[model samples]
Target: MIISFIGKGGVGKTTITLNLGAALATYLSQRVLVIDGNTRAPNLSFLLELKEAVSLFDLITDPKNIVKANTEIDGLKVISSPIGSNAELDFEVLKSLLSFFNLSFNFILIDTPPSFTSETLTFMELSDYSILILNPEPLSVIEAYRALQIASRMNVKLLGIIVNKFRQDAVVSLEYIRRNFSLPILAVIPEDPMVQTYTLEQKPFSISNPSTPAGRALMELASYLTGRKIEVQLEKRGIIGTFFSLLKKLFT
Candidate 1:
């Protein structure tokens, strides 16, 4: 299975994608391959502390290059951003890369660029489903919808929406997005400081602090995507929260 995480700028898409990718590995206990496909602003290397690693660019540009991606955690592999990144994505080269990499893993998650680009479009087509991450800002919502439109235009199947960095007082709530897009809001990760700490400390939140509310939420979200019966502990936030979530679900 291939899943690509795409969304708006400054919406914690990379951060969430990294942590969620880690969470997905733990949830399934399988060898998971996560690649930083966003060549423009590659933050996955920074977040995961693998800046010097050989990236996709190396794989695409070099025929003689041989590499094996290894992660600190077992059953997880990562292909960090290459030495020299390029904004213009070569669809033919990327398609070749996808075919080469697809043979090595049972599940692969790609951390994508902020907006639709030649690169994003290439990866979107390679993926089985696209996970569109968004915050609770109006512009974020609008851009996410734009991404959904792009997916439709390319005929890519979207997994659903993962609402990260969301706050209740959010200018635009999840309800607005569901009403507008009709996509499943797989999970709403409320605004939390633990996530920030994980970033500062340079550890995947799910791996460093799996019990944190946000970490648990990501795990549950992964379970939902994989069709597992994980307990829904987040139900305690309150009836009003649940009501609005339901309303948003209906609208979406």
Candidate 2:
């Protein structure tokens, strides 16, 4: 499945995509490929701790160069920004990367740059599933609507919106998101400081502190994606079965 995460900046789009890909990586033995489509500020590799992986920038700028894949994490491989320092984005390069020989990955997650840039709009057309990440804030809701408008025009399948930073007393906000988007809130991640702690440690929150409220919500999301009949946990992280063969290869 080609899932692209898009939304306004700082709304946790990258975080969700990173953990989502990570969660899937643990469950499936097939490779999970994550491309840092956020050209302005590519952080998917950083979030997933593949600081040394090849980046999207290079692939987009010069397709002739092979994108070196890194096996930093089990079942996960990454491409980073290849000289993506505010450079003019080449959408065609990205398209080739998505459709190239690497299309056999079990799940491919693309992290888009904030806003509806040409690159993002082009990716919208290429992705089979696009998820807009929204917070309880009004601006984020409007941004989600804008994203929906763009995705609709681009012939993209919007999977659903994920409500991040959910609070107990955010009924009005939730109702607004539910009413405006007219799509189920795919998942609701509660506000928690454990996320901050994980960031400080440069680890995905769902992996480092899988017992937090946020982590369980992520597992539910994984169960939905995988279509696996796994029980959803509320306070503890659900351990997706790992490939024993892959794990042995990982540590050996």
Candidate 3:
């Protein structure tokens, strides 16, 4: 399956792309290839702690360089864009690249720029499935709606929406989002400070802090994608734990 991740800037789209690839590869034993499409400010290389001499741009310029640009770590293969190389690639080249990648990996996950740029639109058009990332903020919701419209126009199969960075006092409810946009609320990831901490440490939260709220949520998402049920007890932090406890009590 080819699934592309999209959302507004600072909405954790790339984070979802990286961690989802990790979860699918690490936990499910699937060979996953993650392609970075964010050319202007690409960070997948930085997040993965990899320094590649060749990148997707090189591959685009010469398809035979595919072997050199591909990076593998712990079962996950990444195709990175050239860092500090802001040249916009031809959309046809990206489509051809994805077609080439699909032959070898079980899954091809793409990380796109915020809006419906030519590159992101091309990805949406060519992808088999799409996972839209949404944060619980007004502007984020608006951008997500625009993304959804673009996906709909491209006739892409939407896997579902992954609501990122949820908090107790969030302005909008999941129900509100669901009613506004008709898509399954696949997962609600809680806002956690560990995400920032892991970013600073150049580690993925799914690996460094898998028991945190966001980690557990992502694990559940991965399980859903792979059709395996694995049990995990998410460790709760002070006030958030108390809040969830109260909600559980009230619901029960």
TM-score of each: 0.83, 0.83, 0.86
Per-residue lDDT over 176-251 for candidate 1, one digit per residue giving the tens place of the 0 to 100 score:
8888886888888888776776676567877666666787888887787677754433324333543465577679
Model 2 lDDT per residue over 1-252, tens place? 788888999889888887777777764444687777876767765665553667665665564433356555677767667445777656666567778735568788888889888778877777878888988887887788888887777778888888998997864477777777866788999987777656654577665556778877887788788887444343443333223433565799
Model 3: pairs clashing at backbone N, Cα or C within 3 Å: none
TM-score of 1: 0.83
Q: After superposition, how far is residue 234 of candidate 1 from its true place, in Å?
A: 14
Sorted by TM-score (best first), the order is 3, 1, 2
lDDT of each: 0.75, 0.73, 0.80
How do all the candidates rank in terms of lDDT, highest first?
3, 1, 2
Top candidate, metric lDDT: 3
Spell out the clash pairs found in candidate 1: 55-81, 55-82, 178-252, 182-252
Please identify model 3 stretches exceeding 4 Å from their true place.
51-53, 62-72, 231-252
> What shift in Å separates residue 49 of candidate 1 from its native position after superposition?
2.7
Query: In candidate 2, which residue pairs get closer than 3 Å at backbone N, Cα or C atoms, i.e. clash?
Result: 54-80, 55-80, 55-81, 56-80, 57-82, 58-82
Winning candidate number (TM-score): 3
Give me the displacement of residue 222 in model 2, in angstroms.
Answer: 1.1
What C-alpha RMSD separates each model from the true structure?
A: 9.3, 6.0, 7.6
